[model samples]
Target: MKFAAFSGVFIAHSIQEAMKLTQKLGMDGIEIAAREPHLSPTTSAPRIKGIKALAADLGLEIPVLAGYMGGFSTASDQECEQAFDDFNRLLDMGGELGSSMIRVAPGGPNAFLAHDYHYAKAAHWLNKCAEAAQEYQIKLVLEIHNQSLVETVDSSLKLLHLIEHDHVGMIHDAGNMYITETDYGRDSIVNLGKHLFHVHVKDEIRVAEVGAPGTFLNLTHRGEEGFLQSRLGEGAADHQPMFDALKEVGYNGWITLECHAPYPAYERLAHDFQIVKKMLSWEHA
Candidate 1:
């Protein structure tokens, strides 16, 4: 399986630095975050070209561009059009960067309480985005993240069914799934089946208890009380079963590390890379 590092972790550094560090860490690719200090909707054409050339020069793949656009689940007609317009820009940027896929969010921050109609709205726009992405020969992978309508496997599958587009798929974000109390192992991978287009690995552990008020604290999800980021294998997340499930399903796609531990950037990435290498037995290879 191909391995990649999410550039969001390197937001403090320049895109060039992030790429170089990713190569040094023994990752095959770097998933660029389509945001500031790296890229954005207003990024100049010349800059995009420069970034692409540098990636090629460094011999690193731009597997996917993690986008920050969402709100399909709760937007007015005009707002929806604007969001789609922005997505079109992202697709253009992804094509220019030689990325095979673009990450899309299912809904806005409060999508956990989204109604059935809200899900339909997100699905409809995703279908449109999928059609547009096909022209660029790129796929749109929805993120199964907390606070989103597709946080659970069942919900994600339902949205995919609604979308019904060949180029549309989903990313199994195990960390976020853990926050939402979704199955993040064999059952989830098997149930997603052909719809699983990508994977994100990270670890989090509960740090506080929920009281009667039940107010969700920062970094906590609806299903969980409070949590903090932890290194791979050092956290409560059991990645072995998840990796075994991926192998069992023959999923040879990109497994992007989204490490967010408290350690220094390079140390955290390098350490997590070693852990993943051992899990996948790539160290021997």
Candidate 2:
């Protein structure tokens, strides 16, 4: 697997600077956030080509374009149609930027899947995205994150199976999956198996508990969402088995470092760049 950096790590930074940082750190590629200061569907086509030209000049690949839209499982048909149009624009941009994968969430905060928000909604929507991705000749990846309909492997598979498109897949996020009742990362990777298309490398350390052993707090019972920013291996999440499992599955895809801690964009991601390379056993080679 090759290393990549998520431009979200350098929030508010210019895409030119992000590209420079990625090149400086020797990351194989970058996955830019589909938002301001990075990119948006409405971003001018010339600017998109400029970004692509810069990546080529720096010898960095633009592999993924991550979108932040959500609420599919709960949004009304009108909302979904708007999102579909937004995704179409993104698909067009990804093709222009030479990105092979376009990342999106099934639904983020307030998904409320437990309250009659069925997988069918996500599946139907992703089927549409799959069609768009096919036209773009890129894969549609669902970022496994908390507060989304497909936060866990089971739920993720439920949606992927329903879509049943070759252009659709999942990107594993260990930090996001840690709080979903973790046994390290074993079960999480097991469920993903060969369905995994990309990996977001980060760590989480859970703190602040309410009940006793064998009992855990539900999402509502949790104190705050602070555990997600833990430093590499300093958090409750152990990623060894996760790496091992991916290797077992022969997952040779982009492994991007998402540094939220060890703060100040460059310093943190620079440190994490080494950490992730080691995890992939590239410490020396």
Candidate 3:
């Protein structure tokens, strides 16, 4: 396994700056955000190539395209067609940047409506997207996020099973599954162990008075209500066990550090990278 960081946390800076920061933090690779203020394949080809060249010059690899943002759940026919066009464009960009995987989300208001509806939409589009990805030798890893249709482990696994394609996989994010009421954390890795193509390490804390529903907070806020980002080893997530589980299952993909740690983004990201490296028993590769 290798270490990488998401560029979105550092979106306030330029893509080059973000990449340089990741390299300076002693990370092995980077997951570039494919959105505005970053490198969107739709509008920036020359810039994308330049960024790819810069990473290669620094002896760093672009393991995944982290910002292929678009949703197709409620999109009209034209919107859906545009989504496919965008998907193909990103696959081309992934090839140009030497990345074999692209991260996407299940977009649509319906995602929040019902499980069966969301899962069906996701399966249909993912399969169609996977067909395009297969042509470019790129895998589309659907990220398990809090707002999307496949927010939980079981849902994500079911979606993957429905897609039923080798070019489609899952991204297990610790923070997204951090809830006080359930043990979805352990089940996430265990159930989708085989289809995990990428990993996002984040932590959250749930705080509430006894007998009350605890408010989830990320490590960054520490004291805020609801979930907030946190530094590694300081939040509710026990990442060491998760790392061990990944190792047990022989997961060799890139483990990208998503530094949602608030305040002093650079320093916090550096610290998070080091913590994850130690937990994964990672050395400079």
Q: Taking the candidates one at a time, how many backbone clashes does each contain?
A: 0, 2, 9
**Tens digits of per-residue lDDT for model 1, 1-285:** 898989988889999999999989888999988899988777899999998898898888999999877678887878778878888998998988889999877685434566778878888888888888888999999888877778888888877888868788889988888777778988999999999999999887666653322123443344446766878887777888888899898998999998887777788888888888788776563
User: So what's the TM-score on candidate 1?
Assistant: 0.93
On lDDT, the candidate that comes out on top is 1
lDDT of 3 by residue, 229-248 (tens): 67877778777777878888
Q: Against the true structure, what is each candidate's TM-score?
A: 0.93, 0.89, 0.87
State in Å the error of residue 148, model 1. 0.6
Task: Report lDDT (Cα) of residue 11, candidate 1.
Answer: 85
lDDT of 3: 0.73
lDDT of 2 at 106: 75
Lowest-sum lDDT 10-residue window in model 1 = 211-220
Alpha-carbon deviation at 164 in model 2, angstroms: 3.2
Poorly placed runs, candidate 1 (over 4 Å): 108-112, 209-224, 283-285
Candidate 2 or 1, higher TM-score: 1
Cα lDDT tens digits, model 2, 111-178, are: 33344346778778888888877867899889777767767787677778888697788888887777
- Supply candidate 2's per-residue lDDT for 127: 84
Model 2 ranges with Cα > 4 A deviation: 108-117, 209-228, 283-285
